[model samples]
Target chain A: MTHILDIKDLVTNFYTYEGVVKALNKVSFHVNHGSTFGLVGESGCGKSVTVRSIMQIVQSPGVIEGGEIHFSPDSDNGETGIDLLKQTERFMQDLRGNKISMIFQEPNAALNPIMTIGEQIAESYVFHRKNQIIEKILGLDRTGENLFPKVSANPLFLPLYHLALHRPDAFLLELIKKVPFLRNWDRAVLHTAIEKSVELLATLGIPNPDKIVHQYPHNLSGGMKQRVVIAIALASEPVLLIADEATSNLDVTVQAQILDLLKDLKKKNIISSILLITHDLGVVNETCDRVGVMYAGNLCEVGKVTDLFENPKHPYTKALLDSVPKIRQIGDLKSIAGNVPNLVNPPLGCRFHPRCGHAMAKCKEVFPEMTIVDDDHEVACYLYH
Target chain B: MVVVLFGVSVLMFSILMSFSPERRAVAYATSAKQIKEIPILVAKYGLDDPYHIQYIRWITQIFKGNFGYSTVASSPTLDAIIKYLPTTIELNLFSMPIIITLGIWLGTIAGIHRDTFIDHTTRIAAIVGWSLPTFLFALILLMIFYSQFQLFPPEVISDHIDDFISDNPDKFIQYTGMYVIDGLLNRNFEVVADALKHLVLPVVTQVTVVIAILVRVMRSSMLEEISKDYVITAKAKGVDINTIHQKHVKKNALLPAITISGWLVCLSIEGSVTVEFIFNRAGLGLLLVKAATQLDIPVVLAISLLLGLIYVVANLIIDVLYAVIDPRIRLN
Candidate 1:
């Protein structure tokens, strides 16, 4: 199997007035190509920070101090992938929402309130797909050499339109553009973008996409807004979609619907791979092929979802799996014994040894590297070593 | 809006009516030499009548466009407003744009460069501008520019330009009462230059004093907006850093500043009394001061009504602007 993303020795910290909050501590993980990968952890356990670091969008005061995130965008050349953390911010800006898109947690606050749905979706297309859209416009203009007689007849306008579409910063088109009536070409080009947005909305199964495109975010329900947000992320047809708790805020029915939509998208080959960051164990169990269990900024276990659920290795992973109640059980719902450690002053060595039942003297002395115990299953514990 | 204006007028009338007929008769008396005629004037205007009757008489005269007379200007109250309003309007026209653009620009840089030297300097400047007394600021500027350098003078225009307009009616048409505008119409750039020179200090004083609140509003609003989830979403969606700040964040930040700017418009148009008085410009604010001091009730009442009307119109314009900037707000 080939890996799509690999994070090695990633360290992220938040500089604050109090002290440095160690958000991510040498966290390492990977997502397989064409497979759904889930990272599951407790509420404050740095799951979001790991993905945010990948996209290079961590807020201020939170800095990626050191890491090497090699992204294999071209599946055939996975061995020599480019290091994402070493790339320039300009390169990252071009890659984000184009090669690797992200969906945020809050649906109500994700979309801009003042912009129309069509405009919101079209923004990504305009930013990353301008050349594609411009080509589309040129194709439309050359349909049997008679796309629109008015535009085609004006030979002067066509060349200027080409120049306007390409070198928009030039003063030639700007002079002509200042004439109020010459704005027709702008509307025509914008119409192409809006049409593409309508198609994207339709693919998301939004009803009456043509009408919905003209509506604002405030006009939509919670589920509908999430769908719109998803549609926007899918605007550039990224190779990897990072859904950061995308379905947590919706009701049960809507959450099920969204999850099914994600599953359906994968099946239809509409999306290549998904890196879903969620806290719901049920969500991870049903959808993910592979899972990584994290405990207070450290990845404790990584394995196939079925193996991790049935025969969990790391003590924390075992405790986490035990905490979930089955459909028909005779025993009490087992909860973890101790609180998750604070990241600012997390315990030295293994972060979970204070609560682990199998605490050894070495568990308090040194942190353990990930060790493969079985085929395609790894655990970060002295027991595995 | 009309009801509100009516309410304001009634309130002012009741306050004026609280005084004795002899005291209220000051509105009718042309001069203090006619002290003996105070009773006769009171009788003629029914100043001693019941409250409702006095209110009805005053409201009737206002509706009939007979705003008594202005002893200060030696003309009708309406005529005095018409003659003096242009100077105040011109002063605000120059200062309001400077106030709005400068405030928004300073606030945007301050918000973007949070905790940096630029932010600290702008914040301190805003604080000083806000805390300093308006009259003191105006006086200091007047002393520096008019007294020290003698670079700029005060009042509406130089005596020569005023004389030119009054002396040559056929040669230079007074198309508008504002000399800067009318000078251009008449192709008299000298008059325009003279008028603008006199405008510099007052406009400076007005903008410096009034822009502080707007900057504070804009800065805090910008700080709040850039932290919104939509901004993060924009960054996530591969938007260029410049567009995220200038377009998405700025458009949201300007919403609060728009409300503050509405107050700015009214504050300027009612014509900063301190600015007009310190500069000795014959605008409506100066006229207002003269009217109030002389107990010229008709002139004071008319000015109050005009201010009430201006507030209503400013509110309507603000509503329109809000609808334009924010899609969540719709105007019917």
Candidate 2:
């Protein structure tokens, strides 16, 4: 029931040639532990901007005006929560691929061209599980004793153990000297990492993972590339995975497959939560436990999927839901009028006032605050207030 | 096919023009008897026969490595070519690394920091260098460094191998024709050091124009690569900016520059003429100019053929290199 990640009154702005563009103003949402939370909005609705802010991926000219992104690490002992927004970039980097990984929209561009898919995935495991891999290689576990009885019995390695403990620097120097010809040893390490990556890829329903891992990103199909990207994100067993329009570039069938893969992973990997950012309301309906609707640069509504779909409280959310074609419905599919207001010089009060059907005189003069309607639903509109 | 056709035509034209009797005497002739003497003069050059026969005889002699005698040098045309080829190669070998390294490095930096003061300054320098003729730049460099500062030697310092061997025969064979290479091969640190110091100004003069062209090309290519979606993806993946530059940006950007560099190498054989002249170095550029001015048809044709051959070979090498640098370029 506890929230794994929380964003409070987040505001992100960009300094442009025209003026300060408020990309995200007072936007707030949360992902409960082990729950898939969907952030659905049109382009420029601050969905991507919000997730990037959590990952501290925003570049200069785009500034975090105010916010806090608190992440509660999923640990057996229940460690203290960390505020990601306040952390230095170095600290964020330590947490990024390890604690929170992201799968971007374009698979070809998302993966590095110069590196093979296997090497890049292996790097994640190498960086985050350095100590674990080292221990596995050295045949020692955390207790400072040999895990393998055969390894412990080797008389040749006895001096190595003593050297490692008594003269660690000398041991390292000796190791470095043998490294130029350490192909077998290096292969052993890399092979283990690749095996782990392949296993992760297979779990994502990628056929012939063994063949796929050896290939470069360009060699794979679009869907395969996406699946490989997903495999990489899942490599470190992160607490949260951000799929930034991960399925947008894929075909409809592939999109369904990718969605199913994510759902399966979520069920199997009980500790991980997904923050799915997309513009598709139908996708959110199928996969998300809860949905947050955004308009312009503000969160217009946040509610349980069924409630938001059946009874969207905010005028903007209602209009968005109406826009989706329904097979059972008789009347024409309603579309929201007007484009999203310019962020540089947004409408004075409610950004959607220009198009909202229920816009009152006050709606154009005063901004609305999010008002709780039920334990699970919240709407940001004058009607709710 | 075009190159081959052009080359054949040039060969024929050079031979015909070289063997033609002097026009001045023909222009002054008043009688048939005076003109009768022209056939003897033409016969002396073996030009009184049919064009095809004359071409066949010339080509046959060329195939035998007898490129005919140079009217200007009074030596076998091939001998003149062989004597000058090494000097040109040596000059290029000395100058190329400087140009490429400086060009690529400065260009990459300028492109990465576009719109900044450094970018503007590099742009200005490139424009000035590229706009000016190579001979003009060479002369300016010669005047400033050689005539004014007395920094360079003004000509190559020829050390006889016989003298070097007799005085220090042990080290004589080690100092290759290229003093720099010889210094390194012999492990004569002082000789290597001294050769580099002597090499400074001429190398600088040669590199100036090359760097100007290369920097502009490399900068634009790098800037284009930087804007690619892959770069954004790299940033999103949290790859460090410098690593992205080294592994992705530089590698990708170098492709176009590498192709251009191959052509530049062939071009340098001809391009460095002015540079060689400024330094009074005996390279093919100076040879080419002198041959052209003196209408030394045999030498001119030989040099042109050598340059054309170099251009074709360099292009072939570049095509092969493309497959190595970019996996997308599949060799047919």
Candidate 3:
């Protein structure tokens, strides 16, 4: 099986005035191609930090101390995988929106409020798909030359279009662009990009694409704005879509709709894999194929969603599953005993030993390595070992 | 806006009314004979009436463009403003652009490279510029550039250039009532260069002091804006760092800076009072100080009203710009 994204010993730290926060500690995981991999954890368990590291967008004061994020731009061909951490920033720019795109948690804060929805969505195409768009324009011009011989031969658009595609900043091109008759090529390119943006929005199930395209983010509802953000992410035809708590901020109905939309997009092969980060276990059960349980910057368990939920091995995962309130339960839900340790000075050995119910003296002295109890199921605990 | 203007006019009138009717009458007197007939003039202008009636009469005259006589300029107050306004406006036109652009540019550099040597240097510069008294700074610059080097002289155009323009009006039309502009219009490079030479010391003083306020405001604003979630979103979209800086961070950061800009412009006008006085330029600020010292009530009142109007108008422009820069402001 080919993994679209693989991680090995990923470590990230935040340098603050107080101390260096060990946000992520030697974490490792692999997201299978065409599968929805859910990272479930409590707040501040480094769930967001994990994917932010993968995308190389961790905020300032935080640094990726050590990590190997092996990403295959071509999903079916594993041999072409590159260590994303070693890639140049310029190379990362191309891979970011083109091969891997992200939908953020807060739609209200995600989109640039000043820019119109259409321009924002069309930006991906203009930046990443420039060659393809230029080629398409040239192909159309060729057809026009054959059919409308007199018009095509007389107009300066063909040359100007070539200049705009090839040497956009050429002095003669800029000077010619000021002339009224020769400006059509540039306008046509932008117009066609906007038309593609409208189609992309329509594909995301946004109504009144023609109207919404011209409106700012402030003019759209929370749901509509999230859809626009999704439209932008999907515009470049990314193979891996990382939804960072994408539906957590929306209303329940909107959340359901968004989840359904992601599922439908997956079914249609618009996205080959999804790294869905959420605190809600229900969302993972409904949407994810595989689940990874995180505790104090550590991945405590990894297995299929059903198997992890039914047979949680690590104490942290078991406690997390037990805490979910059931309809018929009369007593209080089981709560984890200790708070998440401050990662700056996290507990030694196993991070969960301080909070575990059956922690032996060995649990405090030595950390257990990952032990496989079932096929495709792994847990990091002495009990499991 | 209208209500605010009206309130400003009323407030100015009431302040003018605080002077006894006899003292207020002196504003209408032009010569020794008029001074003798001050009582009659006072009654004619309703100076002895209730304050509201007095305010009405004053506004009625202001509405007709009769701002009374200015003892400082020895001319009609309106005529004095017309003559002096252009020089102040010319000084601002040169300084405003440099102050705004440099302030924002330096602030962005400092904010982006926060805690680095560049940030520390700008911070110290801002502190020094902001803390030093403007008049003292202006005097120091005048001493270094004018008294010592004799490179830049005080006052509006030099005596020779002024003589050339007045001596040859046909060649140099005083368009816009500004020497630099009129020189440019007439293609007189000598006069334009001379006017700019005279402007250097004052412009430098104003730019330094004003940039301090803006740099601090913009630096904090930029820091706040770059930390916002939208900036992260932009980065996640694969935008180059410079593109994110220019297109995303700068535009959003300008909100607080825009709010400060209009006030800075207005404050610079007040700042020019000292700049003009120390530089010996015959602009409105110089006229204002001379008028106040000599109890030239009409000129003082006129200038006070003009300053109030300027502040109001600057605030209106700032509000409009706020709406233009941030769509959220428009929605609200």
Candidate 4:
């Protein structure tokens, strides 16, 4: 079966003052449909970088050197994915928040502080769902209190409607838009977008969304703000929702509520797949169906959560599992030896070689390839090979 | 606001009053003969009275709309301000919008196209603007545009138009002292055009001098906003880079710029001295600076209080604008 999202040999590098920091080293993983794929790693292990590269939203000083993000929403009937990296900016612009949306780590930071909640959520619709909103506007009745009858009353209505239908950046639309009160012709589309925003907010379980729509991001509680952020992501009904440490910043109770909301949305088939990035192993154990363990810009292991937890193959994965402090049972948690290697000049061969107990001469000379160690389990280590 | 203004006036009055009574008496003297009677003039204005008594007397005079006499202008302080304030206001009215919008637009482009040729070009412009002394820049424009090309004369209005307005009151009424506005009100477009022509160099000097700081402030603010998580969130939500910068980042970035701009307006009031003096335009800056050279404390005290009022008003507007832009600041 075709996976919902597949990342192949993704290499991302950060050009900083010191040197080229090799942040992501030929990382490859595939997230299946209708399941939570958790990527757990320490801070700066390139988990966020991986998803940012996928979304093509990586800030400057960092570049996606080489990568093929194969995204094909239809997983059941065998449709080969399109390389997202190869798509044009316009294509990517539409694809983002429409097909593949992201829920950021800090809800406090994710929502625009200056913008009202309605405007923020409506932005997604305004940017990507113009055509959809236009279609909805076209179906609105020509009479009786809808914005359409009044819209049709304008002299430039037909031309503007046609221009809006053809391209959002129509020259005529811009020319006539300077005088705020004079631009009555385009109000129908804007009205529809706002209406859709309120609907999306209500669907995402935002309380008093009608009033909340007009309120700024700062007015909301942490959980409500997260819901607003989630509402913005889910505005266009994205098939793949990438939650990048989304619940990491919230309190325990809020985190649980958000997690439950995400799970419920998934169960209801509102979202096709979730690519959850977090360093919390417990969170992964509870929520994810599959897990990918990352270390020093490399994906060391990926498998079903059960298989990976019960029988972690890679030495790095085993070390990571052992490091997690258990509830009321740990004597002293065992940490992997050595600092996370400086990615600018990571160890030449396998990045884990310096810390791996089973490191051999060959392991120090060559980076190992992924080798299947068990059913639905894969590990990138010399021992596995 | 009233309390602040009153405090500003008292502070300014006391500083001016610190000069010896004989020296302060010079501001009250009109002629060489009167200069010789400094002691008599000092007693007449109660110049040697205790500070509070003198301050109370000054405040009572202000309540009666008497701003004392300006030795520099050879007129009352109120009349001098009325004559010069409009010229300064008109000059700024033309340049302020251009300075603000152009600086903001350029800084935004530089920020968004960061580290590119466009960004570098703007940085160079900002540096040139910042480093070039106002008088030198104004003189260079004067030499090139006024002397060499004879394009714009360095006067508030051309001699003929000035004479025409003064000579032909029926033909060209001075509805407002601002020659440009009055010219338009009087339907004398020639006067308006002449006023604008003469204004070009002074406005340019003000813009070139005042704009560097604003651009720097705006550029840094834009850069900070660009790195904000909301900006990334906007980007991740499929918002175009332009929309993200314009709608989301620009509004958030404008808070610091607003404060800087309020300061710019205040600074420009003081900063216009060089431009006005060089350009031969009678504005508060040049008037106050000339008064300072002659130790004319009355004009100095009057203009200082006026500037304080303007600063307070500008800050109030800025605070209101800030609260409007960022709701988080509303409560505060």
Candidate 5:
């Protein structure tokens, strides 16, 4: 299978007054095309940092020290992927929320409070789909007065609109933007962008989308707000959707609903793949086709979800799977022995060595490298070697 | 709002009443010829009555627009306010916009480039402006501009332009009691230029002192908003950094700065007193100082009431602005 995203040896750090935090220490992973990849880890184990590093949005004081994020938006076309880390910020912007988008953990904080739902959704469309919206606007029959006839009727924009309809790439349109008085032409474009936003909201199954578009984020419920945030990410039709704990903050039913919505969207080919980051093992088992177990900035194991759950390899992954209680005849819930280490000064080798029941002398002195153990399965442990 | 204004007026009136009735009666002496009839004036006005009666009488007279007489201006207290208020208003009209816009602009730049040289420099400048005494700053500006360079002089207008306006009533009309506006009304460019030239030193002093607090408030507010999750969402949405700065960060930052802005305007009004005094401009601030020093109770009481009213109105406007900026505020 072709990889949609290939991240190798990604290193991210946070500089502070105390010390430089090794947030992501040579972390390596990838998401395959048309498949759901779940990255599961405990809190503060670099799960969020890993995805944030891929998106190149690690917050201030956190920096991406080095690595390569090779993203091929058109994965099946046999095209060479571009190293996202090397791309200019302008290029990254074009890729983000267009080719790749992220849904944050907190729906309440994800959407802007002051902006209307319609305007929030419309922003992404305006930023990345201006040309498409303009083309859609031109397709309308202009024989009579349309929704935005005021600009068209103005003498200043009469000729401009004619060119925008016949030849959108006309130099006159570009030059007209330089003229302060004539720049009202773009208002028609914005008006059409709003129209497209309404359609996007309707697609998300938001009731009475026309009315909801005018309402603010605070006017919506938790589930509805999450849907709005999803609608925004889908506005540009991203090829890869990163759901960063998108359903963790929700209740059981809402979480189920959101997960179903994501699955439905994946089935509909709205998003080609998803990078689901969560700490819930149940969520991972229910949705992910593939899983990567992360522990303290290290990927301990990678395998098919069924294989990883049934035939877990790394000791950490085995312990993680053992911790989940079955439905009927369950023993006491088993937790891993030790806590996640501080990344600033993690253990010398094998970050989990202190917690591992099978820790050997070598495990304490040397970091284990990832080794392929089976078809499409890899593990980083001395036992695997 | 009415209740708040009333409360402020009561507080001010009670403070004024603390002075003995003999002192309050000095307002009724009216002219130099009547100076010897202080006791008689006190008796006629009932200045020595019970505190409640005095309070009731003062409230009623205020409602009736009789603010007593100002010995300092040699006119009615209300008349003195009417004549002097325009000067301060004109000064504020020029300085307030500059202070607000520049403060927000500089604050945003400082916040966006935080920990950089620009941020350090702006913060250092803010500290100096905030700590420097207003009168000392005004005096220094005066020494540099008026005393040494002779570039811009203080006072409301050049003596010749003042003489021209007073002598030729047919040519110049004081429509707004502001020379700038009146100059435009009469097409007298010389009057407008002279008025603005005299305003430079005072307006500069006022803006420098007031902008310091505003910049600090806006800077910290912006830093807090810039780190919010919504901003990260905007960045994730591929929104341009500049758009994120203006729409997401700056708009949210302005929420806290709104309260500070109101306070800054109030401070500017108070700072105008020092500015006006040093520059020899006949504004409300200068009038206030004269009134306070002479124990001119009527003038002082009227000025305090006006200041209270200004605060109430400014706070009301800030609340409205707060609702406009944050939709959640509208829900309440």
Candidate 6:
């Protein structure tokens, strides 16, 4: 299968008062097209940083020291591919919410307060597919011939003479004078755009889209707002959707519902792939086809979900699996030893050496590179290396 | 919600006052004639009605913009209220923007730079602003700027545009209630400049304390907002630092700042008394102070009602603004 997104030797660092923190160290992973890839790790293990780096969304004090994020568009000819890391912000803006989109964790806070749900969703649609919406609204779709004749022979009352008679400079000056800052003209345009936006919201799952479109973000319930955000991300039919702990903030029931919605949408829309960043191993087991285990800031293991769960190779993966409580059994679950090491001054050799039960003297002295143990399984530990 | 409670309390007080035989005694000095007229005065003011009925009548009159005649001034209380309201509004409008802008900007900078010299200076400034009595500050400012430097005149400046227009009979346009508006209307550029210059010291004196408080509130709120998970999330998203500040930090910080601003505006009317006295400005503060000093019950009651109404309305606006700024707040 062709890789939709590839990150090679990613190293992200944060400059802080304490010291230089290596947030992500030599992280490398590939997410194939139409596949659900799960990145599971403890808090502060750089799972979120990796996903954010893919979308070119890292902020100041934190820097991507070295990395390459290559996203390939899944066209028939495979002609569209771009290195997102090297692209300008303008280019990234064009790509974001169109070719790639993100579903944030706290849906309540993520949506803009002043903006209505419908308007926010419609903004993505208008921005990415302006011509389509305008054409549809104006009944100007030209799928047939005689397009030129239709344009020339149109019988609608033309304001050509009126427009011509009003000199552009004079007209503009008059408009400015009457509006006192040209506020009214902008409002007229905005009002039309907002009207069309309500129509777009109707296409989403919002009930009474017209009424909901006028209501501010505060008026909607948490679930309704999350649906609105989902609608926004899916407006442009992006090929890759990054759900960064998307269900973490929600209750267990809501989490299950949202997860099911995402899964359902993913299957129906076969063109898109999901990159699910989560700390919940259970969520990964249920929703992911492939899983990548991260330790500290390194990708410790990568394998098919079934294989990894059935016969985990990496020590970190084994410990994580062992820690999960099984419904069939009734005993206390095993817990992973030690907390994640501070990235600012990480231990020498293996960053996970202090926590790994299988650590050897060699593990403490030499850092291991990822070694492919099988056709679909890779582990970055001495056992596999 | 608070308005409804206040209204009820005022109604209850009015009813309690009506039943008491001392209504005339309270209204005027006790004498043989006054004692005979006590029941008549009570009946005239509808003080004889039941508490609920009297409350309804009072509320209806207030709704119809009939605040009732002043017992002391023998003039319409509403008119007296309307006359003083514009002056208070002018003072507030001049000072509010300065306070909000200066506070947010200085506070944000201080918060962002925590222990730096700018931060330290801002902290000291906020401490002084919060701790110092408004009356003392007003007096000090008056002595320094007006008495010592002679930079400001010790009176409210009123270039009556109506009188000016009547005298000149050419410039009639009045877009704003400000002198600047009148100056511009008559095409008097020099007059506009002079007006602005004259306004400088008074506006500064009125706004200084408010600006200091706002800065402190904004800084603390910004600091708290900066530490939220979403800010970290935005950072991880590789969003520009400036975008994070503008979109994430600023909006979240606005919550507390806005809440404080509402209360501050309400309190400012009361707070302005000392400042008004110091500047010798004929604003509501001065009128209220004078009314209270002279035992002018009618003026005092009118002023209290007006202040209460303004406070209620301002709080409502603040609540609406909260919904505007933060989507998490549900209006319903």
Question: Highest DockQ, which number?
Answer: 4
DockQ of 2: 0.30
Q: Candidate 2 docking category?
A: acceptable
* Model 4, docking class: high
- Native-to-model Cα distance after best TM-score fit, residue B294 in candidate 1, in Å: 1.9
Give the least accurate 10-residue stretch of model 2 chain B, judged by summed lDDT.
B19-28
What range of 10 consecutive residues in model 1 chain B has the weakest lDDT sum? B24-33
DockQ of 1: 0.80
TM-score of chain A of 5: 0.90
TM-score versus the correct structure, for each prediction: 0.94, 0.84, 0.93, 0.95, 0.94, 0.71
Q: Evaluated with TM-score, which candidate comes out highest?
A: 4
lDDT of 4: 0.87
Number of clashing pairs, model 3? 0
For model 1, the stretches where C-alpha displacement exceeds 4 angstroms are A140-157, A164-187, B27-33
Every candidate's DockQ is: 0.80, 0.30, 0.72, 0.86, 0.80, 0.17
Per-residue C-alpha lDDT of model 5 across residues B1-332, encoded as one tens digit per residue: 77876787778778888888777777556688787788888888787888888778887899999998788999998999999999999999999999999999999899999999999999999989888998999999989988999989988998998888899888888889899988888888989999999889888888888898888888999899888888878888899899898888898898888898897787788778888998999999999999888888878888888888888889989998999889997954
| C-alpha positional error of residue B98 in candidate 4 after TM-score superposition, expressed in Å | 1.5
Off by over 4 Å in 2: A75-80, A143-192, A329-331, B1-62, B111-128, B158-179, B182-198, B227-238, B330-332
Cα lDDT for residue B160, candidate 2: 49
Question: Which stretches in model 6 have alpha-carbon errors above 4 Å?
Answer: A16-21, A59-61, A74-81, A131-225, A248-264, A268-270, A282-287, A327-332, B1-90, B97-151, B158-198, B215-255, B287-306, B316-332
Q: Compose the digit string of candidate 1's lDDT tens values, residues A258-331.
A: 99999998998778899999999999999999999998999999989998888988989888878878898768
The TM-score between candidate 4 and the true structure equals: 0.95
lDDT of 5: 0.86
Compute the lDDT for candidate 3: 0.86
